[model samples]
Target: MMKLASLGLFVFDASTFPFSDLNRRRDWRYGAAPRIGDRDATQYLGPGDELVTLTGALVPEAGARYGSIKTLATMADQGEAYPFVDGSGVVWGSFIILSMDERRRALLVDGTPRMIDFTVELRRVA
Candidate 1:
């Protein structure tokens, strides 16, 4: 319903929807990658910064949703890692753009990154 472009650093939100039907097997999140414990906590995202699973939206003051968000599994990364890092040395997880119609400006949620055996292409832009 919405067209989404990478905000360079995975800065996504409800307003950020893909232009195409992102309902594919690959587009869903399989799991997260293993992270190092020594990494600085300041560099990682806080629970508030990331979307959380909520039951209902009673408090209108906060951006709480009235639905439950499912937790994704954390699969392993056996191959080369993505070039981007969240300042924690832990690589940013990858998601396959199912039916990603680059020319038509449409993208679908394909399969998990590990299932398809591909890497998420994250880059830094100035």
Candidate 2:
């Protein structure tokens, strides 16, 4: 099995689930002071905020499991930080789940989703 990345206990792989898109954002904080008849002076404060967004689809017919989404929701409810790690053995940092959105499509006879598209947003806490 090929592994892509992992957020705490949730793993991303072909047999389980995989994220198609991974976006990371990093921002720096700065403060500007107005000067009389001159250019404003800007002072660099420090690192502002960092965020990561993962988007993917889960298809049960293709070996994806639906319970993974529920596990993520449970983790989010705990309001704790989890370590984010990539398959390449890179530790991104500790992050907390900011939000999770899921859209069910192609429903089955029992109203279960055949295909589920999901987005998970995380904010770096440390």
Candidate 3:
């Protein structure tokens, strides 16, 4: 269970385990695919620039609890380094928030925030 600095990005979904997808994929695949299983070349061994991509979701209604989602969702203006820590308090990496999903929106009766869910894509800083 890694935590991002975004606040409540995890833990909002009582039915889902937020940090379940804390994993990285390091590979470079460049080829021309004429068919689904056909590749002209399959040689991809890159250091990935010593960076790992971390993907997680802010709980639905994250904005309501954490304030306006715009605070973090405004990616073009909020390109900053955020700390990424694992459940054991290990500094895994500094992640850069790539983009913000509008956090799925909905029209409700109680007038809760429209944004219910948002996903974050980040690259680990080396």
Candidate 4:
């Protein structure tokens, strides 16, 4: 099996939790100064913010555990940054979990979800 990516100890792979889509956003900071007779002078401050969003689905029949979401929540509660690295060994940076949203679908008689779709949002801290 091929590894997709990893955030700390949580690995994204075919057997575990595989992400269907990955989105990244990078922003730059700028400052504007008022001018007497011309347009405001804009100065590039530096980098503003960086964010990453991972969306995937978890299927119990496919070996994905629902507790994995809880694990991520625990990591978020710790308020610590984790290194985001791809399968090719590219280190994105240290990031903190900003939010996680999940939707349960195809419920069973016991009220357990047959599939859980989730989105994880992360912010670069380092």
Pitting candidate 2 against candidate 4, the one with the higher lDDT is 4
Candidates 2 and 3 compared: the better one by lDDT is 2
Order by TM-score, highest first: 2, 4, 3, 1
Q: TM-scores, in order shown?
A: 0.16, 0.95, 0.49, 0.94
lDDT of 2: 0.91
Task: Put down candidate 2 lDDT per residue, 24-114, tens digits, no spaces.
Answer: 9999999999999999999999998999999999998889898888888999999999999999979999999999899999997999998
For 11-117, candidate 3 gives per-residue lDDT tens digits of 31223324324455444545443657765655555545334433444454432343434555653366667665655556656667665554444657886545455
**Segments in model 3 whose C-alpha atoms lie over 4 Å from true places:** 1-23, 28-46, 49-68, 74-76, 109-111
Against the true structure, candidate 2 reaches a TM-score of 0.95
Clashes of each: 16, 0, 3, 0
Score candidate 1 by TM-score against the native: 0.16
Tell me the lDDT of model 4 at 46. 92
Q: In lDDT terms, how accurate is model 4?
A: 0.92
Lowest lDDT block of 10, candidate 1? 67-76
Q: What is the C-alpha lDDT of each candidate?
A: 0.24, 0.91, 0.47, 0.92
Give per-residue CA lDDT, model 4, range 31-76, as digits (tens).
Answer: 9999999999999999989999999999978877788888899999
